[model samples]
Target: MEIRRTPVLLSWICLLLAVFLIPGHCFYLPGVAPADFQKKDPLQVKVNKLTSTKTQLPYSYYSLPFCRPDTIVDSAENLGEVLRGDRIENSPYVFEMREPKMCQIVCKLTPNEKDAKDLKEKIEDEYHVNMILDNLPLVVPIKRLDQDSPTFYQHGYQIGVKSPHSEGKDEKYYIHNHLSFLVRYHKDEQMDVARIVGFEVKPFSVKHEADGKWNGDKTRLSTCDPHARQTVMSNDNPLEVEANKDIIFTYDVDFVESDVKWASRWDTYLLMADDQIHWFSIVNSLMIVLFLSGMVAMIMLRTLYRDISKYNQLETQEEAQEETGWKLVHGDVFRPPTNSDLLCVYVGTGVQFFGMLLVTMMFAVLGFLSPSNRGGLMTAMLLLWVFMGLFAGYSSARLYKMFKGAEWKQIALKTAFLFPAVVFVIFFVLNALIWGEKSSGAVPFTTMFALVFLWFGISVPLVFVGSYLGFKKPAVEDPVKTNKIPRQIPEQAWYMNPIFSMLIGGILPFGAVFIELFFILTSIWLNQFYYIFGFLFLVFIILIVTCAEITIVLCYFQLCSEDYLWWWRSYLTSGSSALYLFLYATFYFFTKLEITKLVSGALYFGYMLIAAYSFFVLTGTIGFYACFWFTRLIYSSVKID
Candidate 1:
């Protein structure tokens, strides 16, 4: 039975190691559509004349164009041609942006009576208010280059809209907000000129810069709140047909010679569609899922199944000692945990937290919530933490009961206050440091007060209620009854020290994410983007494995030392992961970041609290499960007459 269980556990460990290598193993998939789903480029598109004075296209000059090919629609074309009016023989081909939002109609360079009168009529019709011609800016000339064409020649002029967010709001420009461009080749040289072929909206974005160590720039909109700014539109009629879909006019002209030629669109698009980060994430997620599944199966089959089978075989003899029923050692089980009372509370709180997190993650994976919802992850998790008040209260109260603590009142009071108080103290100190620096990262005084109010008003009451319920229930019964005279403990091995064993347990989980932590910090403080849910999920599995193995190993050592205080050890053994995580964050700030200000440092620690709390919970759950099983194993295997 032991051999079977040992192999199963080993198989799981081997599988975990194998999965950890997935980030480097997989290939990325190509994009299904253009980078942005819309007709416009997500990034700024430029068109420059080879002989032009301007180094880059001015925000004004480049106009978006719609091309009608005789046969197919061109959605994204880097190379385009400028053509002369009506004549195929002498027309000049100039490069232009084929995207609809890039399109613009310019007035003639030297206005005739027809041009001047037409301009006045067009401005009045477009703006519905008189606009001055002198104020109108001259267009610049150039062509957009794509993969096939490296460069295109200069031309007469180009026209484009000034961005909506340009320094001045009063400028008069006929911005085509909802327009998308498409190109379709003419079916025949003599058919109806050309019809609108493709449709899509323009992509837009505002500029942002990181400010100082904390990177809080109030001038820019928060990424956390995407809808903070307003967008301008071309028309007042909400139901007005969009430009790409609603074509107002069409005209046919002779085709002129252009340098651009059709290339294999597949190769062009595939190159642009690849996302390395997303590729890595998918592969990593697959490996971790397989790894964890294997580990879980091995543990259940080898250890748990064997223990249950052995116990079942002895049912007749075990039934004879009905008073025992495996947990006759209730007195020893309640032995006081060594070290500190505060640490006990801390570990218990962590256990409760981990329980909530697992349930939340499972829900998220099942599609109850998505990662795309910015704060939806944090918000869902916070609600789960609140709901777990019961577990915190129960674990703390029951452990205290086992310590021969007759003061249920004191136990209950401490159970209710300990975790919350520690959190508040840590938070208050960090906030004070932030307030001193006047950093944007500092929590507003009102917000701090509200947080306090929530803690006391909401969490404290729930915890107190949980404590009341926990104490109302009977203390947990131990499997083997304790002897009136305590048994002599055998001399422990050198590694049996609680501190030493715990340190070993922490290493696996920390090793799993030590490298990934830098990237996580970069995303948060350095303003780098990371949406690698797969890597995150893998780290999560590693944390579980580390917690369980470490706890089991430590529980064995504690049992050998005759320290029946395995209850608290089991909780704290895994929970030490939180401490390691906090240490890692501190190290990351000093080694990886250039952050100098104390407030940013304080905010960093403030963020660490959230991580620490999460780690504590996750590790705590691992310890609890491991110790629970270990205890059951020993009770079932030991000879009891």
Candidate 2:
């Protein structure tokens, strides 16, 4: 039975690794399948939220004085989309498959003082107008000198530009009133059908003049003459947005056949120019892992083996008394440390975070959370975190029981509420700030209620069930009995002080992951696509190994010095990496970002603080477990009577 179980476990482990580590393109998203269209089918264009890197706040698409549909109905949003501040809605711009339309008007708008002020503010902030057609996001193609084709695509076009007036004095706001769209489609020769593959737009500011008295006819403009094939040109008079000015919104749609297929349409959007840099980051991380692995192997094979062998050969207590180092702490090594309850709660929360991240990454690497499915990643993370409450409760309850604590319910409640409550408070504060800005990034009351429901209704009950099950089982027995009277710890060198050693122990783990951390920050703050889940999963594994190994090494050194307070030290030692992560984020903020708004700055730091706290929990938990296993294996190998 043991032999069969060993093979079965190994097979399962291998299968799990394969599922997580495989290339993302191998598997497709389940519900978001590809769409095919027949000839002349109406393709509706939808507008998404307006985003700006400068502000880091997304606003509703129709918040500005733009053309709107009659009903102005919002598109159905998933949890992820809502959280991401995506307010997708139907636009007045309509299209037909394989058909060309020229100089079609999309409603004219007369701006009020408030509208003008809002448009000027958005233009000054450099917000982009995001649009979607057939689920493909519209992009502004940027030409590159190195490439013959326009491979680099900006996610969205700038709403308008702030240019100096003709007097070359004060700057004036110019809105791009005319949009020339090029819709690329893949045609099927056999079935006489086509699929929309690309949506590109070239924006212009054309001041139109009517040939005759305008009676609300859309196609009666001299500047955009349809008969002679005249179109909006960049050199045309720019449309300066001012209060009470009538702004005519016009668009042209041109369809073109493309070789790119619907299945691989997102390939172009996901192609980044920093592929080589990502590879270099992976190599650097691997080198750090290899170095740490070598050090750990030496400690395990040479030093640990010799010490265990000599200790086991002792004939009497006198001989054992002469022995120094880790052997001296056998009686007190497993002793519960001060504030063990808090430690248990932290470890349990870390377990929950670890499970959530691991599962989310697995799904991401398997292509279930693709870039095309906006907000899918955030939604998956949130749902997974809620479900992982079970692990949190079980781990905390088990640890508390082992520490000889009888109040299982109290420990379970702490495990479920402590970390989450802190995070929730911080999130709520940040949401309030966003609400003050009147930004769509703020969480709605309905969503907040739903979150509370998930916590209390589902997660809290699941945690209680797990804790009950954990407490019902027999408590885990320590390998060696802990003495009733604690042993006195010896004075150590200044370098071995808890704070100093923890700071030192965290350096290597931070070094291993800082490279990848750059790209993650860029993706979040700079609004770039981050689909390199395969590299991310590898880095995550490396980060885990580095954290564990470093903590084990530091714990061994501390134990050899007759210090038995390994419980919290092991956690803080690896967890200190989060301190460095937060510091690096601060540095990134000052040097890389150009954010000027106070609220935007606050938002960045607030979100980063949450991220750093999560990192601390995850790394600290890994270290505690590694050191626990190390101490147990070492002490159990010798006679301890």
Question: lDDT per model, in order?
Answer: 0.44, 0.86
| lDDT per residue as tens, model 2, 285-375 | 8898888889889889989998888888873656866878898889999999899999999998999999999999877765668788888
Q: Which TM-score value belongs to model 1?
A: 0.51
Candidate closest to the true structure, highest TM-score: 2
lDDT of 1 by residue, 1-641 (tens): 22223444533443343245432111111111112122221222222211111111111111122222223322221111110000011111111222332222111023345433433323222211100111111121123556563323122221223324434434332323222222322122343222222111222211222223321223221221223223212222221112222212111112222222111121211122124554454445445445544665665577546645655566566453553222344346534546535544665576567767677654443323332222455556656776676677766666656555555556556756766677777767775664564322345566566556756676666666766676677876656666666544456677876677677666555655655665666655543233443345556666676567657656654654566667666776766767888898988777876555455555577768767876775677577767777676667554454
Instruction: Check candidate 2 and list the clashing pairs.
Output: none
Total clashes for model 2: 0
TM-score (all chains, Cα) for each model: 0.51, 0.94
Among all candidates shown, the one with the greatest lDDT = 2
